[model samples]
Target: MIKIYSITVTTILLAVVSLISCSSEETSEKKQENLSTSPATANYAITPVDLRYVKLTDDFWLPVVKRVQEETIPYAIKKCEEEGRLHNFLIASGEMEGSVKGKMPFDDTDVYKIIEGASMTLISAPNPELEKELDRIITIIGKGQEDDGYLTTWRTINPKKPPAPWVNVVEGKRWESLTASHELYNAGHLYEAAYAHYKATGKTNFLNIAYKNADLIVKTFGDNEGQIAAVPGHQIIETGLIKLYALSGKEEYLKMARYFLDNRGRSEHHKLNDSYLSAAYSQDHLPVIEQDEVLGHAVRAMYMYAAMTDIAVLMKDADYENAVDKLWQNMVEKKIYLTGGLGARHEGEAFGDNYEL
Candidate 1:
């Protein structure tokens, strides 16, 4: 029972807007926003995905895989795999933790679970060396973990755990928690990664480890009263856990995820505790899909809905999927930008309407 006290008083309002008008040509008044550095864009066209057989990968799975494996996970895995390395690699090896040229040093134990997950994508990616990195990455998670199955590089190093401390930390350079708390997102990612890895190689070790960690998360967060409401900052875990439930015949995972989804934006859990912290994170502040106009964080919103869709499918909940379908319709038909980027403004790093980006 995670309760976000911050946003309980601030009600989230929902309204349905008409979908974007159909048009053939790009708006003529467009300014050339320099996207030379953007990831290579494919035509944004996609056939309607039938999840029954094709196995609905996350909509952003491919781009996320490309970024995580080639860019983020390799460097992180290298540091994590090194002999007796203490910092989060999900740490950079031989790279200065305090310098400019090194990899982003995120040496927290809770965070590495994400690196493990990001590395997990190699199991599904097109690259062979990436596929090879999965086992080595898991080994790093195994080595760095505490005996209680607690593994977060940050917490491991900074032993004095603060309640919701992650939500408030701001570095001189950037939002530390944006990426750090993202580990939960990473954990969800890892869960997906482990499932993909295990299926790719017929090895249950990866998923088995995920089940262990997820059980811990579920146990601790299961039904505590004075905590945050709302959902995970990253949404993929819901889908990941749902997939796990579908495969393992486990109702517990689905139940826990349902708890996460149901409490989101509701006043039920947050009225007692640190609810205002909800302002620091947005997914906690609104009902899924009811926020028709995408607000708050971008990555968090999409992943959350993606997970919502997954659960809706598994339980055959038309209401949830209808919400997902509405939002999906909005994004595909109205909100998405030209390069397939969801959020246009980097400030909130969130979605803008079609042609608005």
Candidate 2:
């Protein structure tokens, strides 16, 4: 009887050990499965930048590009042709605040925005036949391109090159500022469109056009003599320039982008107390990171921060990434409304407060 009881105890111990070993093996397999699916674990499926860029380009940006291309840009051009104003660049319509004026006798800058927007359309919705139409549109936008590679309707129409004065100094005035002006804005958009075009269809023409545009920008502006210190009202140029750099594998473009980004934070223009204050207001204050909340000019802030994050993530800068992370977190988690509305009130075109969503 004692031997039988001992044998039973030994059998139970052996079975328990075997059961534990099996459980351990299963747990290891499960971990492997989990790692495979982990979004942040970085498999070949996608990266954060890719998703973010797509979200911005596909969902948010594509519609606006389509609307402007089909609706706004052509309408503006037709109006110009009808008014015999086709030679001059069309000032953007709707209420653009009293202070945000144009180069007048107009410039060709915005047509690229429309063109780039249209290019993005082809990217999001690839229609091979549509490429021909896009090519036509590009030609139209490029119609004003100068022999020296300069692309601006204002210069074509209003030759003083009537320096872009309002950039980076005022709230409502930034759009009129050079660097912060429409021309660079157009370049930025074109660069983005070029990137989308390449991503969507593996073509290089779109990227080439934008690259030439950047080269023109680099030649025209900078610390060089006769060049002003101001930048564009929008922030996309920095990222756009960076993209162009990567596209071409040229270091100059990256330097240009870095220069623009660094300039924004150095606190020079804002302290000038110059007429550009309105333009600076247009850019929504300096010290990009110190901006505790996402405030006025919803669209502008979104682009600026998004590009900033792209640069940060690509470069692996911890401080920049942390700031971007905080801002993005705030925008998505605390401030976004249920309808996908961002800013609660469009009055200032700014955000109200967190949780007000």
**Every candidate's lDDT:** 0.50, 0.52
Q: Number of backbone collisions per candidate, in order?
A: 32, 29
Q: Give the range of the ten consecutive residues with the poorest summed lDDT in model 2.
A: 1-10
For model 1, what is the alpha-carbon lDDT of residue 18?
8
TM-score of each: 0.60, 0.62
Model 2 / residue 69 / CA error / Å: 11
Span of ten consecutive residues with least summed lDDT in model 1: 9-18
lDDT of 2 by residue, 27-57 (tens): 5455456444422222222222221122223
Runs with alpha carbons beyond 4 Å of true place in candidate 2? 1-110, 117-128, 159-176, 201-203, 220-227, 269-284, 353-357
Off by over 4 Å in 1: 1-86, 89-133, 161-183, 224-230, 271-281, 353-355
